[model samples]
Target chain A: MDELMEVLRRALPKVNWETDQALVDDGIIDSMDVVSVISEITDEYDIEIPSEEMEPENFNSVQAIYEMIQRLTEE
Target chain B: MQSIVEAVAAHARALPEKFCIADSRRELSYRGYWECISGYAAHLRDLGVGVGDRVVVRNGQNLDTVTAGLAIQLLGAVFVPVEKNAADTRILEIIEAVEACCYIAAKPMELSCPWEKLGDVLSFRDESADFETFPYPGGADTAEILFTTGTTGKSKGIELTHRNVVAVAENVIDGVEMKKDNVEVIPVPLSHSHGLRRYYGNMLNGSSVIILDGVIFYKKLFERMETFHATAMDLVPTALSALFRLSGDRLGDYRDQLEYVQLGSAPIPQQDREHLCRLLPNTRLYNFYGTTESGCSCILDFNAMKDKKNCIGRPTCNAHFIFTDEEGQKIEATEERPGFLACAGDMNMKGYYQSPQLNAETIRNGYIQTKDLSYMGEDGLIYMLGRQDDVIVTGGSKVAPDEIEDAAMQFPGIADCGCIPVDHPLLGKEPKLFVSMERGAAFDPAAIFQFLKDRLEAYKVPKQIEQMDEIPRTYNGKLQRKKLLELEAARAAERSES
Candidate 1:
């Protein structure tokens, strides 16, 4: 998860994704950021994220995203 | 002939408890919405924002933005809606340019101008306030001053009249076949002309709107649609594409629920149009063609014209066109030799705010000369060839960027691409291409060039192709050519320094 955050931070240096729970809801990150995160995770995780898992909840918080990555990796 | 304020008041009287609008925090019924408008009208009056005054409002999409905009119009003040997320200097520049009487923002900002936070005064609702008592403005009165996306130059504020707004409302309503029972979830920015016009039409039709912050919250947009039983929504093409790419076929689940989908402020590629038609077979897909200066005059129902390519449909009942040659003479354009597409109608803006030179250049013979070069096809529909201003002349040959970009889209390994003009030593100007590669795809420009060379004309072929992390686009989806040029200049400077 820490490794994933490092990848995310490269895209958005300003955001404190670790502490921000409402990233999408608060408009802290937008569609562009969402695209970068998806692109980064695709390369870093070597796992394709299914379309159903692209909802706001999965990307709204650091913990939520970490869990999603864990769940996908395990599967 | 009834004004929008009168129409809303009628809705308030007839369907007081009907859902009118909702932001992230609060929901308002028709009656409640009226109360907010009335209260805010009085509050703005108290602050000396009266008839014919200009108020600069830089606020995000929220309840205050919704009501205060109407309230400003209620008091006969011009509503100047700039992007809330715009730089403070730009916001201040607009305030100075408009010579605004007051500035309103969603949050506190350090500025020397007379300003008020949005919720501070606009939220002061007196229970006894009545919208019925307000003096109505004339049809010719300027209601809004919306800024253009400024893709090519400095953003100019377009001054739209009350008549124009009403005409646009009717056009969109007729174009999309909007219904009173419709619950439309609005993810488009309320501050933009497209969303503002949508809101006006929905209000006139007594339709409900769930104003989610942005379309980035696709989950909320879809969730609200399901929860409210929403039958409609609006999006720009790029945002729609982003959602389409991110979610894949999840949008297919709500096919039956969605009656119509509106795409405005940008063009929809033929591929997406066909895909959406297949995905939502029952849905009415509308591709809008208009600008801040002309409102939404041409709307193509892709569902109706499934076979037509590059068609933006005939002008609406209120709008008519005046195509002119390069010499400003009206000419009948052919498919091969297209004329400059110009618009003239009740929906056209009065003029740009304080831009005499631009007004003179743009507004000629009662028509606004659009950047688009188009021709009327044999089917008696308008077909845009490309932007007249955006055309690149390579070795004395006029090249449309759309042709190049469209060809590039068909090439594999390229996720996104745009064609912009760059300087050439011999030709003076040449076409330059930028592409963003798909994940794990190789940036093999030579192969892509070979592919595009076979597809495009010799002069139309880009002189240089560069790979970018992303092709920067304006919020509403127009290519940010200036940003790309700036980046190129910065790169050159870095190279020189190294």
Candidate 2:
């Protein structure tokens, strides 16, 4: 989780991807940011994040993103 | 007709029961739409709103918003629409800038009374009010004051006349091949000119419009389209890209029903364009290139010009474009020496609101010049090469960021990219690129540098390539190169501190 957060921090430099951060609702991450985050996460974790699974809930924070990756990996 | 409001009122009298505007929850017939406009206009009139007064209208994409806008115009007042969900501070700033007579919000705001509420206005509609006899200003009268997206304190209000709005709508109708029976689905912001003009044009042709708030509601959006049996839709590139992502391969299902799709306000990626073409093989896809100040200047028939996707096709409707050098000399269409793009026609704006200096600088001899640099190809199509301010002066040579960005987009693993000039001790300034890579792709700045080196001149190749999560853009999705520069500067400050 820390490693995932580190990756996000470096890629999305001005963003606060902490556990409490509301990435979408707070306007922290927009559609363009979502695109980049998805691409980076899938490549780094060797997981395929399908378009249907791309929802705001799954990516609202670093913790949320990490959990989503775990769920996709298990699937 | 002097204005769209008067024409729409006439249409209402002819066909009172025809559905003019519809959303998920409510629908307004032409008669009902006209009545609502009149009622609102009367209410505004009671509030001391009259001719030439600037009214700040902040409402999301909906039926009431459109009608309220029409009502304001009916009273000969200029409607200044701020983006829905804009912060109160931002709204206040714009209100101050325009010296708006009254502020109207879709929902309740923190501001006190005298600021009209849209919900209250909608509830007080006078169904018997006759709107046709209401005197509207002539063609040259200012109809709207559209504020283009800009950084704080630099927002320029574009004053568009009745003729300007109607001309752009007509240009869009012709360019997109819209018909009277066409049911156009509008999912973009109603505040902007593109979406507003598309609605106005359709209304002029007596066509029905379905308003969907956002593309985020994919299920509801598709359901609305199917329910309305929509034949056409208009959206900017960002919205279209998101739709493509959300729908994936399923977008092709509507190809038969959707006659055409208009995309503008930002550049569509070649990959996205090609994929969309495949998805809607029979549907006509257009790359509409125009400005808020200049309506529909150029429309590229992407279906026919598949080989020249980068080319913005010849001028549309009554518009005429010319490339002018620094000395204001018109450069002939010889496919060489790119220069500033200047436009002349009915589509051009009257001028910027309250800014005489800017009006003089931009509009010269009835020709409105844009900062965008372009060249007229031998094929007679216009090829844009980024903004004039985007040119990097390095080693006594000028390099356009569009060429570099386009070249970078072709390299594998890169999803989106932008290039900007960075100060250098040696060359004065050098080009540096910021890229947002494809998900799961490896970071290889060296590989990208080498790839660009192979294709471009040495000075054109970026000195540095940094991977970023996203590119800064305006609310309407225009690339904010100025914001990117600020971000780079902040990063440099952090680096020096470390």
lDDT of 1 at A27: 50
What is the alpha-carbon interface RMSD for each candidate?
3.4, 5.1
- For model 2, what is the error of residue B97's alpha carbon versus the real structure, in angstroms, after optimal superposition? 2.6
Query: Tens digit of lDDT per residue, candidate 1, span B93-119?
Result: 888888788888755566666777775
Q: CA lDDT of each candidate?
A: 0.80, 0.80
Docking quality of model 1: it rates as: acceptable
CA lDDT, candidate 1, residue A38: 78
* Candidate 2 structure quality by residue, lDDT tens digits, B38-137: 8889889988998999898886567768888998898899989987756678788788887888888744555533577665666757889775557866
Q: Judging by TM-score against the true structure, name the best candidate.
A: 1
| Regions more than 4 Å wrong, model 2 | A1-75, B110-113, B131-133, B151-153, B393-398, B423-430, B450-460, B487-498
TM-score of chain B of each: 0.91, 0.92
